[model samples]
Target: MDCTRSYWNGRKAVHRRTMMKGAGYCDSDIKTKPHIGVANTYMEGSPGTAHLRTLVEKIKQGIWAAGGIPVEFGVPATCGNVANGAEELKYEQAARDIVAASIEFVAKVHRFDGLVTVASCDNIIAGCYLAMARLNIPTLCVTGGSMTAGIYKGQKMVQAQLDVAVLGGESEEVLLELEEHVCPSFGACPSMGTANTMQMTGEIINFVVPGTGTLPSTDNLKLRRSKEAGEMIVEMTKADRKPSDLITRETLMNAIAFAMATAASTNIVLHLIAIANELGIKITLDDFDHYASKLPCIVGVIPSGPYTVVDFHYAGGALTVMKMIESQIYTNVPTMDGRTWKELLANVEAKSSDIIRTLADPLFKEPGLKILKGNLSPTGSIVRPTGVPAEMKQFSGKARVFSSDLDSFAAIERGEIVAGDVIVIRYEGCVGAPGMTELMVTTDALIAHGLHKSVGLISDARFSGFNYGAIVGHVTPEAAKGGLIALIEEGDIISVDTVQGTINLDVPENIIAERRKKWVCPPPKVKTGLLALYAKNCRTADEGGAMQPWLDDETN
Candidate 1:
């Protein structure tokens, strides 16, 4: 059972064990055991990863019992809610590359036989996968699981509602009640937001243990599964089941299809493409549109419906959704457990059709996603078609432009935005904002002001999973680079047709060309720092905004 690499054994073992003894490792522990690195993204600041400290001991016990030496390391963890707006938001995307680089460095330098990444947030999980793809090691991820929904006076409440309530200026008593019970315990927010979406993304790609992605953090099952994951990592190492062996283009597409079916998150498009980029796999916006075009939104969680991820877990988790869409997925694709996807999902069936709907009668008759392209987005833009009212889905309105998110929020607060306006928030794309922050603040503000149904918001930025209404995001070839959005002037007519899948500036071609001649790039938002580096080197949103190692032009 010696899974130790050559550098950790024989003559080199003397040097390694001599160093390990100071750390309290015995001679036997270093010589015969598999050296497994457990990268923990635990921080006390956020509920998403705060409880992972409790899981570490259980994981270590399991690793020891399974004959492996577990060595734990810490990584930075940021909460999406905490980083929602302001200067901190810019670092959110950059942190993914940081985590990937950290993991890769530690795994390579320590020469671990296997890796088990502990994460629950969106970027952390995406970073773990990217690191795994780069290292090609026997790797598995342990999601900290979702929080249980909070109950306030017989009504089930989650984080999103609390955000809306506070932003909408609810009564002080109601705000106090929500502050006391909105988050019941330690875990990611209970909705299918980016955290849960990334967890499901990892699970469907076979990077996590089956059925463990949506388990509630406080549940006894989640703790048990955390330990089980530690054991699974050891087994995977023994069998030489590397990440490259399981992660393929077919598997990535399978994960995308699952996301579409579940109405997971629009952010999955960015994360999945970034992960695929690490493996040199080209997964474009067109590929996402292709899968989303056919897959109906079957599961309803959070902003999409009244349920939470806890409900999805009780309704048979990812396995149930996979079973429902078995025809679309690569059911025979390889998984970390050495079994095909079909075999793993063989026994799973939906226990509650209310949460996970039947394929025949889905939450949305068409796909949950719509990718639009025209003058507004020459590359593309994304729209979650489900839950958008019939009247709001297709509309043409005069353009109301804002150069920044703060400006847009101020306009909404000042009562300048009207019902028949297309609120344009530009200069906030990957290169523009230097981080592409979520427009949830403005989106929620509009909803609070009773304009969610009437007004349409289009952005070069992105949205949180909880965002709803006639919102279109990820407008590519962004304004900072003189894309179509930069040419848009106040009072210009704009048209958006979800049915035809197009978002266009209704201006004549000659006028658009004339306007483009006067467009100029904005100054860098962050003149120096990690975010500045990211903004300088990052690709467009359509390409997943993955930070390039070198400029593409240099390679050319």
Candidate 2:
């Protein structure tokens, strides 16, 4: 039976049908077509999502052509670059949950037969997938795609380069030129940052249409794919092809393998775990580690390599990369197009060997990302091995602790952060900051000062996908919760070995115990509003930093 029947089939729904007709929908439109919810995260001033309005129009056209009623609705969207370096940044991660809850609230109330989620950027895409898993409905995602790379001095440019130049003391004229040209079009940053990472990974997990993730936002093809997604979702609903049917443990494993091979964002770890939790599927840091050990980094996108995601798209995108590592990923999994993975890439070929390398001749012999565990992070911590230089991979230095990212950035600006100092930024974890803020500003400062390789950094806070260097982040049992990071004093030694996957506080065990004994959990940074509520309910980073009210319910 059509789920929309509950609102339009009988005399009981007369008022609903009247309201629908009043809104310009006719009787046949209400009775003969399925209701497809177009959950669009479109907001002006956000390059990643600003162009989504056009896609939504095309999607509606496709739905109408496919005999479905398209009901458009708004969802929260945020730009990490806008929120970075401010207290407002705390709302960034929290926005993910808001997007998920918002979609759930509206879709459940209106009883959408199928959903077409239009989103771009990191949190928005992750949140949409979380919503899909929570509702277990027939859904397809439309990623806004990557922006075209900007050209400065005849060299391609992306957000990371602009960030480094701004802090590197470039001339005002040069900076102005970069500001104007770094983002030449409306779309996600033209790199394998969180936005593109989630898009590509989402496609591999079967939540997105094939070829849609890598298409440039300005390309005419993206609009066509949006319409195709709208039409595909209607058929998926008729077949009862719920998210659960497409996304399984094997599919997630495939996503992880793809991420590892491509050297995608570390943020994928948190988003993937959150989506898995919504589906009652168990995924942990160990799963990431397992794939990291087996899969080699092949894609050479920005922050980890010389190319941007535009180059990646031209290099044959996700299908080419997947085909390159087919032996490492699952091939029997179901895709959104009703085809198996093997069938999807049966005739695919890589267009550029330099951007997407073969398994035998990978960009890096090691995985792009790794999970580090030691006394410092009893639970776990994340580091991107592909971003670290070989000389700094196994380094030890004196601790220089700061309570916040701002303080750390200030010290870097003041020339107080010297070479061989392991900068420890704390009190910015999920519950500590009330939302785990990205440390892009501080990382950029380090890069600007030429300290990225000479200095090391560790944080309870997270890092932006564009950040690199000798850094570790998302230290579980974060400093605010009185983790070992909170106990480190100035001049104490810390060691990080990305090759061995270990991050250790080199102080004596007895001394460390004493420090922990004296350590106290700090007061809440935010006392009221959404942040306070998030802090009260949010789980640790290792648990995906999700707000699981079920964990607090004793009745269950």
Candidate 3:
């Protein structure tokens, strides 16, 4: 029986049927067809979601053709580019939970038999996954594919390059040309940034159609796939195939293995953990490290390599990458369309070996991402080992601490930061900054100043996927909670060895203990608002930084 029947089939549901008629639905349309919720994260003027309305129209057509009713609802979707480097960045991570809760509220209230989430960008896609797991309904996601690469002065460009160029003090004409051309289309940034990473993560975990993750946003095939997703949701609902049926522990391990092979954004670690939590599965940094050790980084997508995700798409996308690493991942797990991964990838092959290399001839035999633990980060910290410059991978430097990203950025612009320095940005974790804003602005400034290879950055906050260099982020037990990062003084020595998976403070144990004894926790930045609530209750970085109330229960 259809879940919507509870609201429309009974005589007591006369008010509901009357409400549906007012909305232009016939009694038969309400009673005979299953209702599918289309949770759209489309907002005007946002590059990632501007074209989603067109996809939604096609999805509705497919739903109607399949004898199902499609109901579209709007959810919050924000751009990190707009929020970067400002106080507004604090809201970026919080928007993920807001999007998830909004979808859950709408789907539960309307009694949808199945759900189809339409989203682009980082937080929106992660939020959709969380909602799917929480609701445990037959659900499918439609990814808004990557934008086309921009052309500037006969060179291909992306958002990350533009960010650094803007701070590099280029001539007005050059800056204007780059600003106008860096984002030539309305879709996610044309790299393996958080947006594209999470999109592919969905497909790897079997929450999306097989090839939809890497299609260009303007590709006609994307529209066709969106329609197909609608039809699939109806079939999935009929079969009672929920997210729980497909996303087992082994399936999640496959997702992580794919992330490792592709050198995906470190932000994926937080998202996968959060998705697992919603399904009552326990995932930690150890799970990511386990895959990172076994899977070779094969895809040469920026900022880990020279090519863009557009190249990855043309070179066979997610399917080819999965084929390359099939031996390392689970192959018998079921996908959204009822085929095991082994069956889905039977005839796939990489079109370009340079873009998606085979496991035997991979881009980097070293791991893609690593979890570093030491006195500084008692829980753990994250770094993309594949992205770091070889010269800076295992260096010791003096500590140059800052309380905020803007302060460090200003110091970089003033030539205060130099070689052999570990720039520490603290008080910016989930409970500290109350949102754990990305540190791309400061990292971009370092690149603009030509210090990306000379200096290193460590933070309790997060970093953008476009960021590279000797950078470590997501330091646990954040400064607000008296982490070791808050106790460092200027000129104190700190060592980071990405190759060995360790980050340490050279100071003695007695001195460190004394400093911690004197350390004072700062008050919440926001006094009363959603951020204040988030600051008071959100989990630490290692625990996915989720804001759910149940997760806060120590006994649970």
Candidate 4:
């Protein structure tokens, strides 16, 4: 046989991959086989995980078929559906550290040629990004896909919103049925929320196959994509390429720009910051607004627009947005296939006007989130302009704040909170709330009374995926840490000047200074566990909501 024919026939020598994975084997097994790592996040704590296990099995088959061996590795699981508060915050930061470490350790032990990460949830996607940075391995993430759009009275909603609405005050019967109907399958959120955006970021940065990023878990297309990714990983492995090739500093900026233009989850800011920090790169909220200007808000997804990820997939997926924000994304950045961002967009176009708009008539016209500086937030904070009311864009409202998340919750349930209220959910920062937990229940209550849509939430923490309001999260120097947020009290008048890009309390400097002296940190919820660890080392949200202990390690 000719050399070409022999080379093609010899593609079946994947057994060498198994032997390289620290498994005892004879030299005969060491053929010129490509080894692939299947970094699968399959744990019972999260519902979307089941799909990953099933998907990994298919990846294994595809690796063998492509003349590559696939070694599967597992990482810690973070279940958003169950955990809440600082404990959840504890897990979020830990997830990133754990995944990055796991991938590095596993790859070194297995000698894998490339990696295929199977993930879907919000934390999982972020964790995978950190993992990709650590191993710097030829990597690809095949998301389980967002869950089918949840329906209520034939109207579709995402899972997080459904949970929030019910928890806030809807009847248990309605919530139960809606919960069952809302997320009927195992997938990611269909909304243009954090989970969907992060997964697509992987594709836009040329981390995953472009068009394959938005398929849902139940769709057969996801399985086909998984197989294709398996094959792609084998090819990447043979090329000795790693994730850093695709996820360059330029790509990180592109991802941030996309997140802002789409008005995606606040989680992206934190996630991207952490990923950059892990890679020894610097990214700040200013970069978020910097790229936000050139990019247009054309993506038609919820909280920002009217569609879901399902509609986005059929319309154009990441390619659609990339084409719109081409200028924002440096076309020079390298990709997984050794190509540039422009090369990836060559064959793609915005197929549907509804899914992806053009700059001439962009949906948002500018980035959805804006960075504001004021006496209130000396460092900075990010807020979704789309979630806020147009009339109150430049409001000088009173600071009807809560000292803590629990007090905020109590006020909402008691009907004490109302529209035009500048609800301050404080002490829930990296060192304060120590977990940056979502006050979904409180936001839901405001939603129930039609107050959520109008009121603005300013806090030193995070929000739920389902939320839509003029909520501002991740306030720096949080109340517990003695930031201006602690000085806010119930009935204290405050001001929000979006036009001027400032958020400040109306109180005099002398009075505010007096309030500061009396402010005290809230007591710890738990005396032990990761929460304790988080309390001891976690930084403010502006610092990527990560543990401060690791801060010195990176610098060291």
lDDT tens digits, residues 1-556, model 2? 3755667778898888888899899998887688999999999978999999999999988888887899999998889889777779878888889999999999998888899999889888888988988999889889898999898889888988888888888999999999998999999997778899999888898888877787889889888888888888888888889988998898988888998999888889899888888877888999999998899899999888898888798788998999999998889998887889988888787654889998989989989889999999988999999999787999899999998888998999999999899999889999888789888888999889989888999998888889899989999889888788889999999999998999999999899888877877889988998888888888789888978767546336
lDDT of 4 by residue, 65-85 (tens): 887767687877666656643
- The Cα local distance difference test for each model comes to 0.83, 0.88, 0.87, 0.71
The digit string of per-residue lDDT tens for model 1 on 1-556 reads: 3555567678846877788888888877787789899999999988888899888877877898898999998887788788664657756777888888899999998888889999988777778877888788888889989988899999999988887777787999989989899888888898878889888778888788888888889898778888888888898888888877888899999988888888877888888887777777788888878887788899888777888898888888888888888888898888778889888877665554888877787888767677899989989999888756677889889899997777888898888999899999988888888888777678878778888888898989888878888899999888888889988989998899886789999889999888778777878887888878888778788888878655365548
Off by over 4 Å in 2: 1-4, 551-556
Model 4: residues >4 Å from true position, as ranges? 1-32, 84-90, 108-111, 167-169, 517-527, 548-556
RMSDs, each prediction?
1.8, 1.5, 1.2, 4.8
* TM-score, candidate number 3: 0.98
Question: What is the Å distance of residue 25 in model 1 from its true position?
Answer: 1.5
* Local lDDT at 229 for model 1: 85
TM-score of 2: 0.98
lDDT of 3 by residue, 1-556 (tens): 4555567888899998898899998889888788889999998978899989999998888888888899999998988889878988878788888888999999998888899999989888898888989999989898888999899878899999988988999889998888899889878997888999998888888788888887888789888888888888888888889999999888998988998888889899889888888887888899988886788788899988889887888888999988888899889999888889999889786554888888889899877788888988978999998888888889899999998899999999888999999999999899888888788789999889989888999999998888898999999878888888989999999999887789899999999889878888877778789888888767788888878768657445
Candidate 4: lDDT over CA atoms? 0.71
TM-score of each: 0.96, 0.98, 0.98, 0.89
Please give the range of 10 consecutive residues that has the lowest summed lDDT in model 2: 547-556
Better of 3 and 4 by TM-score: 3
Clash totals for all models, in order?
A: 0, 0, 0, 14
Clashing pairs in 3: none
